[model samples]
Target chain A: GAGVSQTPSNKVTEKGKYVELRCDPISGHTALYWYRQSLGQGPEFLIYFQGTGAADDSGLPNDRFFAVRPEGSVSTLKIQRTERGDSAVYLCASSSAGGYNEQFFGPGTRLTVL
Target chain B: AQSVTQPDIHITVSEGASLELRCNYSYGATPYLFWYVQSPGQGLQLLLKYFSGDTLVQGIKGFEAEFKRSQSSFNLRKPSVHWSDAAEYFCAAAAYNQGGKLIFGQGTELSVKP
Candidate 1:
């Protein structure tokens, strides 16, 4: 893809439901990132992937939030037992050609937990 | 833990007026700095970034930012902002060796008045 691509631009799920958000980073990008943005706030880091390994997951709020990039190309963010407080936009980004490169973002998935 | 702060929660500026948005970071090292803009219901677009070299770095959309090491600040500026520049702007910082996981500040909402 020319840029990072995300699927299911908008998602609505009831409490206790599970949801998965997908991201397809640009070809050859070595790094990927996930973030969540609440209303009237800045985006918060959730996770990061370098190659097939998760380099950092410290920013993830809790056990309910999980993400994986199996092949290092496509990644998925899963939320279990969704809560109304989980309602926010999930953003994905990728950087190519190594260190200090700028990240290109996807359109993002607007997840609304009811 | 690393973090960022954007002081002004909301700012209104007339079209063609000079614009400045403040950002401060708390990090052990001189971290990589960035500014991103997000329009209504859209993904974030990178405005500019600072790594090494010059303290002042140029970015897209006619924006520039200066990284002050002692102050731990990276303030974004534009000589004249357009009406189209009305959006939410985010300031972010990440460690160079931290695998690209970014810590972002609370955004500044810019409302450009014609």
Candidate 2:
């Protein structure tokens, strides 16, 4: 089966610009998650969605980071007023229902804000 | 409040040597533990997970992990590592909530010296 897929394998933008990263989860996957990874560091949780609603968003760094999965299939992470600190790889993952299931990840979107 | 620690920033092992990556987590109660691997220009892939039951868990690609409650650790190990195993390894923790929010540690960069 096809695994999770993220678009815009790489993105370069100026500071204070807006950016949107897209993710297409595996078919029939009901859970989706977003994370960020900086250089020499592990991924940091950003948000999670169950079905069409956000199940948890406590990990989102700030209001500028937002995600939506209206149809519970594809998701988009939007960043407003991007800063240099936001330069990192944005990862998307999908999993079966439940808290203990394993997650499948995408190739990730590398965002570079100058 | 929940966090993870990967003490080893980088480790080098021979092509046919045993490998172990340490992971420690700080959570209020029983936590879901997981190990993931990422290669360059790729997404994070799950190696193993431990929620309960047997402390020892087997995973994909000849990987395994042991969950030790006494030490609040879930360490990944392999009896013999191949050169292709060189990559970044991440240990993460997730609470039992439906949200499945994860806390990841700084990854360990494994290099195969052969």
Fnat values, candidates in order:
0.69, 0.85
TM-score of chain A of each: 0.96, 0.98
lDDT of 2 by residue, A32-57 (tens): 99999898888888899999999888
Instruction: Work out how many backbone clashes candidate 2 has.
Output: 0
Write model 1 residue lDDT over B5-96, tens digit each, in one string.
99999999999999999999999888899999999877899899998999999999899999998899999999999999999999998898
- Cα distance off (Å), candidate 2, residue A71: 1.2
Candidate 1, superposed: residue stretches over 4 Å from native: A97-99
Largest DockQ belongs to which candidate?
Answer: 2
Tell me how candidate 1 scores on lDDT. Answer: 0.91
Worst 10 contiguous positions by lDDT, candidate 2 chain A: A95-104
Highest TM-score among the candidates is held by which one?
2
